[model samples]
Target chain A: MARWGMVIDLDKCTACGACMAACREENNIPASGPELAGDGRSIFWMDMLTITEGEYPNIKKRMLPRPCFQCENPPCTKVCPVGATYKNEDGLVAQIYARCIGCRYCVNGCPYNAKYFNWYPPRFRDEEKRYLNPDVSVRPKGVVEKCSFCAHRLVRVREKAAAENREIADGDFTTACQDTCPAKAIAFGDLDNPYSEVSRLAHSVRAFTLLEDLGTRPKVFYLTEGEKHGRFKI
Target chain B: MDDSKYNELDEELLLRPILKTGKWFYISCAILFSIAMFAVWVWYHQWSTGLGVTGMNRPVFWGIYITNFVFFIGISHAGTLISAILRLCQAEWRRAITRAAEVITVLVLFFGVFNIIVDLGRPDRALNVLKHGQFRSPLLWDVTSISIYLTASSTYLLLPLIPDIALLRERKTRLRWLYRLLSFGWTGTDKQKHRLEKAISVMAILVIPIAISVHTVVSWVFGMTVQPMWHSTIFGPYFVVGAIYSGMAALLVAMALIRKLYHLERYIKEIHFNNLGKLLLVFTLLWFYFTFTEYLTTFYGSEPTHMTVFYSKLTGHFAPEFWVMVLCCFLIPLAVLVRKKTRTAAGCVVASIAITIGMWLERFTIVVPTLVNPRLPYPRGIYHPTWVEWSITAGCFAFFILLYMAFTKIFPIVSIWEIKEGRESSVSETADRVKTYLPT
Candidate 1:
């Protein structure tokens, strides 16, 4: 019965890219070799986008960290021919790799371009293989993959809470990105629970979702960097 | 009917290809088969190595594979729309080109379906679309419509062929058993003729809407998506119109080739091409109208995301291909076809060839430009198709022609019996109808 969500506070964030690195480590996303990376085949569950505003002397750099928005009205899932991708009751958009025909219809339908396709079989260096996260399944070539909000960690936390006969607390289940953010900018919790930090931050006057006019109803909210920093247009 | 006249019709038109095996036929077959085999090898390489062999990436997930899928499927409309509608309207010239058009429909539909499989990342898992297909998806609608169209069009092609098969069986050709098996025990009895006519008429009527639905559903595969340029109310009609336009052009090209190669100049005359040229002119004008309205609305509305795609085609990397498409699909066809003096068989052939290429580029322009310019700016994706994609595409075309050539050898490319029927009975009926139209 939980409507899980994430709220990212832009004011506190530094463009350190720790979240992206942590996500790569936590998920089994393969490293596209330098050649493929230059070709824009890099697999990133968490991505950092840099925007440059204004002319010469007045220029400012703003870093935006993007993960899947996990929309309640997901356009990607709607276009998938097979039921390869679907939104769970917990508000996480999940992909079933085995069922994916790799038609890439979902990839085309997605407006945010959050989805990534495995063009080649995932490869990890011999040493990196030992460090691969055991909780995540390595995706095969030809299927699509994307951020899952560390739903595996949420499952572990839920099991622990069930064993203790206690409900999951606000801070119990956090995404790898939320856990690794050095500035403590990312907050993840059940948005339906008013007491949760994500819920409270989501209600802030400055909070907004990307492409809100598209009516995707994204659960990932962004709290604007206060009046001093210029408002993010997109 | 005069016995010598009937014998001459059968000997000159229907039996010549079946009875004789030219060296050129074998040579062409060898070349086409080898090219097709090379394409197969390229596909196997892609299957083993993964889709990374192609030039597709994040935003450009679909490229030429999807383009070919749409292009071939659009070409399929040639047979069903032209043959079926012409049959329904009782156009006498249709007797020469109907079988050719119908054959193109079935063979091109096969390759159209094949292209989708080649595009899939997990072709092995393609059956999952049947097993766990979501009806909400436009792709499911495509599966349903295409399957129906295939079945209906194939049946439409087969129905008229039965009487011809009976004729071939009576001739006792080298493949006597094959003709006997296919003829389905037709004796040319009045009852059998009536039954065959009923079946053909029913299928002819049934196939038109199914053909229309197939392209409309294909368009919805893009239209139903929330992607910037693809999500439009006009896509369904636009795609259907484009399909018919391209299909007409393909039919013209096929007719011209069959007329020349098979020496059926007497059966398929200048008048047939001239009539079809006029039809092509109508489609050319209509295609232009649709293209004009589609872009004009996109430009006038000036939605930012739509504008990105609009400008990408109008002035960006796709501009050259886009203008070429305009010239091929519209201006050249218009210039050649609108003028009565230039609307010769050769002119029609040239115009049709241009439209076929133009329509293919039109599909490419529709699919690639939208994806390269994503709604959210990460980077503008570039898609440069590799040899693997190119080979597979080449293979698909070769396979289509090979199948068609093989079909021509085994069966009559033009419906001989229908031509006979039109010659014997339609003249009297047509004269009577014409008399009614004339002032007393």
Candidate 2:
């Protein structure tokens, strides 16, 4: 019923990578270790895409953080042989790690390259183990994982709302990445609520979803970085 | 009645492989068994550890296992579809070769399915596909179609083997009990013959579509994905053609070996090779046509996302594999098979080996290029298969050959009864049928 969504404004964003760090800390994703990382096996839930535009001396660089699109018409969910990945009524794409057969079909199906697989059993760095969020699951070896839009926070908020006989408010379900953004560049709330700041920002002309022409209709919208910043403006 | 005179020689040749065991059989089996065992151990290590034991990583989540899955399934197309098509067309030559082809279909399919299981990150939870199957997935479509194909092809195989088993039963082979149980009390009665013929025909018709659909669904596993180069309309027919091409090559390889080892040359014949070579040539041309159109369309479109993958295969990191595939699947095949002079059994086998390797490369190029160059900006993923992946792949091939060898020993690779029927009935029936095609 919530139709949860996110909007990231490029102008304010500094690409600090605090969001990525916070996501793993909250979601319990592991550091795949240097050996595995060299094999291109780095595990990330929230990640960044670095785009280098123009020639060497004239180069312009942009770093855009990427989260699961939580697509309205998800290519990933469509191809899961088991119902391990599905979009809930709240319009959030959810992965059931216990049910995942680790076929990686969903990973291949994602156009954004947003998903990561647990090549080894979930490993936590010594300091990471201390901060492992109890509410989040430590995914087993071999299952695919991605940013869940911080759905666990929503569950806790929902339970609290239910106990108080009140409906969940838009800001009550913000993702860890949105909360961690020092620039306040990330906004998350119920997209269905027209009055919500996230929804208002999503309506901005600069806001666009990745690979939108493919019609995935991602709930995650990115506000274009530079238009008046220079040329590369759509 | 005079058929017994000719059948005696045919029986001696075809049945010798079954009646007598060879020293090479033990030696080869020993080699194959060890390779398969090593692969098993590697798979065990992967299970205890993780898929990281293989060379697979992000982006390249699939590798040789998926390639083998597609390749073996393509190889499987060699038998049932070809045999069924030949049988339906009333090709008399099919009588000697159909059983061998059908055996490949039945046995090779298991490994095709096995490759999928081996590729899984959570193979232990593979049953989840069955428990919570969503038909919406192309993978579920693959499961359903391949399972039907395996069942239908194996039954189709068993249906035609009853009369052969009866022959072996009468001969009192060492596996008399097996022959008896499998023969279904087949007697040479007119009623039994008529029923068997009808059943075989029904299965022949049924198996063709099932075979075609299996490969089509296999292609859809990629086609349904919106990945660059993979989302194409032609993938269904393209995959089916490739499957048949590689399958025919595998059949030739197997037939050549069967002929050499068991000395089935007289029965398998130069003429059979000649006909199959011509067929292989046609497929080679078809394969080239599909590959040409597939790439040419992408190149022409110049769609940036697709061009990245397209250029990767043509002139980039995958160029070596891509060009070699063209050489193997098209150029070499066209050279060896096109000229009638060099289309001998040996020539066919050489071309077949090329085509098999080429087809495998084709599968790898198709799977990897798109994944490596992700749609979003990231470092292009690189894949180098670990020893575990290579060992398992080698094991599957050895395992396939080993099973095929065991099948040859247990059953007459060439159908005895079909050969007899061809000698007795097909000769007269062809004359009568050809008469109808001509002016009286």
What's the number of clashes in each of the models? 0, 0
Q: What would the per-residue lDDT of candidate 1 be over residues B334-406, giving only the tens digit for each residue?
A: 9999988888889999999999999999999999999999876577899999999999999999989999999
Runs with alpha carbons beyond 4 Å of true place in candidate 1: A56-58, A226-234, B1-7, B436-440
C-alpha positional error of residue B298 in candidate 2 after TM-score superposition, expressed in Å: 0.7
The DockQ score of candidate 1 comes to 0.83
Q: State the displacement of the C-alpha of residue B108, model 2, in Å, after optimal TM-score superposition.
A: 0.6
Docking class of 1: high
lDDT by residue (B1-440, candidate 2, tens digit) is 46534557888888899888978789989999999999999899999999988888888888989999999999999999999999999988888788889999999999999999999989999999899999999999999999999999999999999998898899966979999999999988999999999999999999999999999999999999999999999999999999999998999999999988998877889999999999999999899999999999999999999999998998999999999988888899999998989999999999999999999999999999898988888888888989999999999999999999999998889888888788877878999999999976
Q: TM-score, each model? A: 0.98, 0.98
Instruction: Give me the TM-scores of chain B across the candidates.
Output: 0.97, 0.98
Per-residue alpha-carbon lDDT of candidate 1 for residues A1-234, written as tens digits (9 for 90 to 100): 889999988888887999999999999887778988977789989998667777989998777899999999999999888989998767789999889999999888888899999888998988889999999989999999999999889889999999999999999999999999999999999999999889999998879888888889999988875663335533
Candidate 2, residue B176: the lDDT equals 91
